[model samples]
Target: MRYKGFVIFTLFLFNIITIKPKAIDEKDSLYIDNCKRDLLVLMMAYSDEIRDIEVSEDNYIYLVLNNNKKIIYDDKKEKNKNAKILDADIQDTLEDIYPLDSINSVLEGMDPGRGRSYTFLNSIYGGNQNEIEKNLDFFSTYCGNIMFNKKAKAGEALKNALNEAKELADKDNRVNNYIFPISGSYNYRVIQDTGRLSPHAYGIAIDLNRNDSDYWKWVDKSKGSKRIEEYPKELVKVFENNGFIWGGKWEHFDILHFEYRPEIILKSKFFGDTSKSNNKKWYEGAPLNDEIENIINIINSKL
Candidate 1:
């Protein structure tokens, strides 16, 4: 009986020793997990351009932008005639509110390595790789300090926009279609030893269908000027509803690019398919308007 008691006591001590380290490991893992979630929220709230997010074992997150392939912008395109000049008043307002030095700091900080990135102007204006780099560098220096400080409102707005976009996409039978992920803070990128802050750094940008996209840079220079005619209106509407601006709206035209620049989109009055004044209407009509309404209804019925 004495020997049995001693064995039992020794076994209990061993179990406690083993369980303590396991508990500590579990606690450490949970701490790391929570830290990552907080950082992700911060990044998503800051920029809308990030797509394809991956979290690694080491706690680093990898993100890539859905930048469209570069293509030529044809001057003779019908849309060019309709392209409204960006509001001068808004431009002036932005200039006054976000000075050149501030823009520069944001750009400089975005670069992961060297401080230069390519920026091609409208194809009609003639392509100059060197000139694009210079302009981007200058712009970065000018607007570097314009930090997006409105967190709670921005997050709420973004979530609302995402839900609206998802509903619209479902209605249009494009539910499986890639919706741009817009939320996240901007980060600097260093590629090929050149540094330039991608618009994605702002967390309000998204790109879709990288495989089927056209970009100005991908256009054959020999063609002189050729504009890609395809534009993803359904996708654009989703973005616009969420207060994002499409790259297709720009003369340089990146059809797949969407950025969170509510100030510009709102000023342009390009609300896409989402009505600003009828937000409540949108919410009520969402399930009805989409093809997935039946599925959603069935799920609700079960509940």
Candidate 2:
């Protein structure tokens, strides 16, 4: 992946100068900008699987998969917070911005990366339990041996993260206490009290050593915050660097939970909060290469 040099490039319109907004209003401008950003990151993170993007005859946007499937960009529906999670489109799934920087306190009523697009997940990982199981393999993590989906480099990323964590454990005994006896990974079950399939169902989430205060519903925010404070920041850094989002960062915190979500990480790492951006191009900070340049060209041309 050209991701090794992630110093992003900016796209100019047909002219070298900046172009005017194509949307009807400022609100629409922001919406379209977000769609473009999300689509860009998805293609970057899943470069091999998410083959291309499309704009329907009616102007609706879609992400076309290698299997020739199309997932909608935004349904433009009026949805309550609960509705967003229960029935998420690609737009709803990435609506909440994940914080890449280390945060000591749990988010308030915001669970980024919690509401997932099953269509997107299934497209890249697997369609069902049986298909997912075919891709599962046991990898030796420093925490313990656990099953992970071999697809999309999920298993490889997990092993790499833990390998670095194990190296950190050598100097800091505290790190060992926190990660040793990893709770589990690769359980094909739905999330508690939800109809949606968990990332674990696709063998992409891992739980580190558990603590009673690690869960939100089990305890309370006070306890969750305390656990978050005591938690080792370096350990969290290692996981994030390897493309996992910590559930501990969520309001509905699951401290032990770390799921592989490279698109989310890449989005935050590159094009964060476009409103604050002063760049001439939407993908301002992204690194460029033949592959990334090609993807950017497709988005620029199609969108």
| TM-scores for all predictions | 0.35, 0.89
Q: Per-residue lDDT of 68-175 in model 1, one digit per residue for the tens?
A: 323211112222211212211111211111111101011211111111112211211112433222222111111122222132233344455556665666676443
Scored by lDDT, model 1 comes in at 0.36
Instruction: Name the best candidate (by TM-score).
Output: 2
Q: What is the lDDT of residue 180 in candidate 2?
A: 74
Whole-model lDDT values for every prediction: 0.36, 0.85
Clashing residue pairs found in predicted model 2: 7-286, 7-287, 8-285, 8-286, 8-287
The alpha-carbon lDDT assigned to residue 208 of candidate 1 equals 48
Per-residue alpha-carbon lDDT of model 2 for 71-126, expressed as tens digits?
A: 88787789999888787888887778788888887889889888888888888888
* Highest lDDT scorer: 2
